[model samples]
Target chain A: MIQMNPSMRAAGWLLTFAVVVAGAVPWFLWGSSQLIGGLPLWLWWHIGWMIVATAIFAAFTRHGWDRYLGGIDA
Target chain B: MPNPALLSGGLSTAATSVELLVVVGYLLVALLVGLVAYRLTGTDAEDYYLASRSIGTLVLLFTTFATLLSAFTFFAGPNLAYRQGPEWILVMGTMDGILFAILWYLIGYKQWLIGQQHGYVTLPEMLGDRFGSTRLRGLVAGVSLFWLFPYVMLQQMGAGEALVGLTDGAVPYWGGAALITVFMILYVGLAGMRGVAWTDTIQGLFMLGVIWIAVAWVLSAVGGPAVAAAGLDANNPTFLALGSSFYTPQYIISTAVVIAFGVTMFPQINQRFFVAESAAVLKRSFALWPVLVLLLFVPAFLLGTWAAGLGISVPEGANVLPVLLGEYTPGWFAALVIAGAMAAMMSSSDSMLLSGSSYFTRDLYRPFVEPAVTADREGWLARGGVVAFATGTFLTSLTRPGTLIQVGSTAFGGFAQLTLPVMVALYWPNTTRRGMLAGIGGSQLLYLSHVFVPTVPVDIGGTTISLFARTYGGWDVALAGMALGAALTIGVSWVTTAGVDEAAERFAVGAD
Candidate 1:
């Protein structure tokens, strides 16, 4: 079983928090009506950010799974 | 969000008949799935309630996916996107997608462990046992059922409205709702979690396929993606931009937080925490969750936004999806998509009824009404409860008390009130039973006051203050309730002893 250390846990959570905040609303693209690939830039940002969020979640689950379940052998 | 009234003129008789046939066929498939699941289901509570704890990756993922994306996703999401802007995607897709996945780990993984250890079936059961309070257990169950009632009705209401829109009022609203209600009672009564999960997997896949098809076809009819984007840009530029009147930072965050946390407490969803066959299954499901969410939400919300670009004019209180599809897609194709919408509603409703029955039996009835009930009798009572609860929610749907978003959001807030206390009880060994009750009871009261009571404005000096405002400083009632719940839980526990009990000690031991 892979046990994530405290610092590693903190870093994982902090990185997730950062990604969530960044994707919550595209602050940088706020009020910008520019189009990207026919969709709004902000909408595209969300699409791109969702991909990023999915990657981050996949990584967290891979690395931090034991932190929560803690070697529970189901 | 699609009003039956606007659905009156679009479909021909043949189209209406085809759509009705497709919907009826879908319901039949659901019943058949239930029959198979019933045959496979064991006589014990564990098998009926949690599928014998043997569900694998695909079924678990899709069941959770289908259960969460209900009529709200099918109707309200698009309606909001069409009316407001694409920012609705931020709430449903981006923020909620990520937040709920994280919560699925933080809350669900822990619950999975405890449930495995204790043979727990419901959230309240776990919490009540951990705190050694029957009253607290009942309170949590009561809160969950209370909120679940509205959400279940929301699905029925969506069904009625969607059907009325598809058949152009050939199916009356009551008839549409009755169709789903009767079918749900039959299937959910016949098959428990196993049936619901299997059917949910089908429904989830069907919904995903139908939405993507609808989007692809509509984009083609409306001159493709670039044309649709240009049309939206020319017609409703505000939709393309951020900082609209409705999609404020506060609004987005608060809505996302409420839904993400509140979903964890939903009787239907909470019960799912215990259904995974293995830790690896749970891990895979949560990891894939965000991707699945985006796959559906983007198309659903984007379709609504594109309707604005295509110059689709929707009346107030009506959904844009059916209108958009009716305009751009073939009759058979439109009918097929409406069937997909029905699939979404049924998937959600069946799961809700199944889990609500478990909560009623395991958490409420078994403990409070029948202490020595046999396992077989308990299963029968749960099935009966499914019928009664579905019938009750169906009748409530006939009254049409609120819009999909209105009732759904309120229920989300109500469930959000339970999150903090449950978290504390799960992780904190010093959490007292009294504190649990106070936290849940008080926070619920606070949240309900905001939901039920009309706001009153009072003049204080020169500034006006609105009492019971739903949102304060951008944070909504759900967040407010959670803060108070957490505060009271921690504060009350600090001053009170946990007593000499094994409940708290059980969780304090190192995880296996």
Candidate 2:
């Protein structure tokens, strides 16, 4: 069962905000490092994350997700 | 202005006019095919949108390959290889091929399975059904709005570029763009996907033949692939490195995403699956598309490599093929190239127009205009959207630089993000609906920010010279968005929603 109760719904905005902050801090620090020199950190981060991302997507698509979303009895 | 003619190794307006006549002749033939295809395509909306799905493996093979090849293979592919060296060719034709192969393996069966169950016509429909969210369908259509404009712009660019080359000064920017826009609008809107697939067969054949002739001529004029390879090796010796090709790793990985993620998920392909009369037709057709892809590229490689061996200067991007055609071949041959190029542009344009309009009409107007709309009205809406979309793209491109690749990459990057959730949702039993929503929402946020911001490329092959990107977060918002969203969708999805709803019956039976 999904754990998202009303409390979790309240937490949604916090997660979204955290996402923005997570991306922004490094970005602000890197501040156009991408423009002048290229965002080495960001690029490497993406490269590393791409692998993770792809694996997650692969798993999500290839493995059955219906059990989680639709529940067992159905 | 009179269409210029080619004189000696260059285009002369008078000679160009002669070539124009040949092009017009080809256009006449295409018009006949379009009109006839329209009549034969039948009255049902499915027939209009997906070619009655009765198309066999042969038609499916040619149609899919032709759709993939587009004007790019004929124009941009050669030129890209010319500038970047053989490395570029291998990266796109081979590397991209590898990505497509992933599609054959991952998403193909799921597509056929879904088509059988739901009579689905597009991605938005499928997503909407799975999620029980017409709002989701609207969301998808909205996302598509961001994605398709750039694609249409690229198709318009191809048309203008081809006309400029074939007509010399006579077919100026506005005129050429207008002509392609009018023709594509007429064919795509009137006949729908039915016209597109049938015409695609012809376009595919014409371009294939032209590439062969052009490559053969160029090779004989120079030597062969070995000689050509040696010449390029001497110039850009590393042109053979799969890793370092001028084409980007982004393209390869992205293509893999496309191959894996998109093979079954694209709206038109979704529609095509339903149109097939039997599941067997789907399997055979799926197997056949790749072979067509392989056959189309051989001559293109030959043309690029041969041109290099002779020390012929390849034009910057699209101009590479035209410049070579004008230089190495004679007048009649030059005219044939014009016709072939038209096929390339038309095939690409028609398909893009259909896909974009489908999103607008089926996904957007229907939901908003009349929530309880019927199938007949949906067809009309699709046609109307086609007119609006075509006119908008034609008009915008006339005012812009008309670079197909730029528009294409932006669209590819944008739409490609959709691949993440859709692909994952298909097979993952544990994936929550919230996860799909999260992945889509999260990725779009990142993708648009990166694309609009246009930060530095994490330059794939070598160091890219990005003025602002040097230290910025190399703006692959699209790529990262897809990745990040994938993670969040999976992670958050599992943690968030309490559990499965009764709505998930279809996905459970034979999800990817």
Candidate 3:
């Protein structure tokens, strides 16, 4: 079992929620059939969002992971 | 340049033979890897089951990647994209990619921590130990096995479909399904987790390489992505846009949520949470998971969507990947890609059978049938369980109950039903055994009712609602069950007397 400060945990969850919602659906891009880079704009939104997700996950694992494991900061 | 005869399942004898040979060669390599891993395996249960908890970052990452992306990714993913549109990418690639990574950290990382501390090998064992209840452990194992059986069968179904398509029906569906079943039982029964992981790593890498090559080759052959997109816009304009009859907001949200939670409960994947050698290894794997998902899913699903614009004719209920490859790529290259698809299926099946055997022996058999079982004897029993379980799934697969996507989604829903209870048990100290059992058992029943019973429409405020519908108001029935399960778990815990507070304290953060 491991623990982290309540404030840190809340912030981590908020970040996760934001990322999840960001990629959940491209509501604003719907009905736009414009193509960029040989793919639909909506499709590109998903692709770019996926890259952003990858970056967020990388940052989370690198920085917040120790706090999750109940390290010195905790 | 497209060969209509080949697309219609009429390949020359030489072409069929060459493709069959390539598939056979791939299977042989997997078997040889199994043999080597068997030689390296230690005698004890931990050594056999968890690979002595020493899997490195790449192996752990690929094994998890390969195990999760099965025949579904190779076949059903593209098939859906071909039928519905590229929005399948949002459901599988973008949303699920991110959601699953988050869960891997929240659920998997915590499981790893507790596993290391208590030396727990199975989810049921951990839950049972925490709540001090053997029946709850056995119940969890039963529910897990119930759902896992269909998923294992799904891989066999995929193998059957892939081979039949690649060989143009020169190989019967039964023959292809039977072939993977026999090999899976042999290696998984013999080598355990070490062998499964080793082969999974090979299969994972092979699948990725072959799919990427197929994508690049197909793109060049179709005169590049720009031309393909133009063709799609001219031919199937609906596909290029979103907000279709199927890709509704609720549909995307529910499917992504269901798959994310469901994947964590899969015996094959859940057990991997305990296999990472260190916190660094686990962190590295989860961090890389979404990227790996995008790499495979985008290409696979995009190829399916592209096939529609290429005017590729697909037979009823057939996967579009093999047909697309056969049209653009040469015989040998297409065969190699099909072999890679087989690799995807085999990787998933082997891991499922390996982890399932552990659940059977440790959680179900040891506690109920033989509490004093030796490590060596338990190891033998687990091997036997693998053989028996594989045989059962193979027999059921011969019936060919549903399409790859249908069967796979049903299994995912079943497993998703277990997630809320497991999560509650893991985090909440007040979660009673009764609450856990009610949550798991109640959710499973609700989910099964939706699956088994026919839908009946009832009028509510002039709006007709279909009871027992697989998807009501675009939301999947699995989410409804999960909502109920969550409610039962939390609601029941608050009112019930806590009998396992002492046992549960061990799982509390910072507790000694």
Query: DockQ values for all predictions?
Result: 0.50, 0.02, 0.47
What is the TM-score of each candidate's chain B when compared with the real chain B?
Answer: 0.95, 0.86, 0.95
lDDT of 1 by residue, B150-236 (tens): 999998888888876766667788888888888887878888889889988988888898899998898877777889888887888
- Model 3 misses residue B21 by how many Å? 0.4
Off by over 4 Å in 2: A1-74, B1-14, B94-96, B230-266, B314-318, B374-377, B454-477, B498-502, B510-512
lDDT of each: 0.83, 0.60, 0.84
Which DockQ value does candidate 3 get?
0.47
Q: What's the ranking of the predictions by DockQ, best on top? A: 1, 3, 2
What 10-residue stretch in candidate 3 chain B is worst by lDDT?
A: B1-10
How many residue pairs clash in all the candidates, one count each? 1, 44, 0
Ten contiguous residues with the weakest lDDT in model 3 chain A: A65-74
Query: Which candidate number maximizes DockQ?
Result: 1
Residue-level lDDT of model 3, residues B1-512, one tens digit each, is 32434432465687787787787777778888889999999978888889999999999998888898788888988989888889888888644578788788778988888898899988999898888889899999999999999999998888888888887777788878888898788778778788888888888888888889998999998889999998898888889887788888888788888988999999999999999998889888877776788788888999999999889888764578988998999988998888877866886898898889889999999999999999879878888888888889889999989988899999999999998888887878789888887898889999999999999999999999999999977889999899899889888888887773338865755321
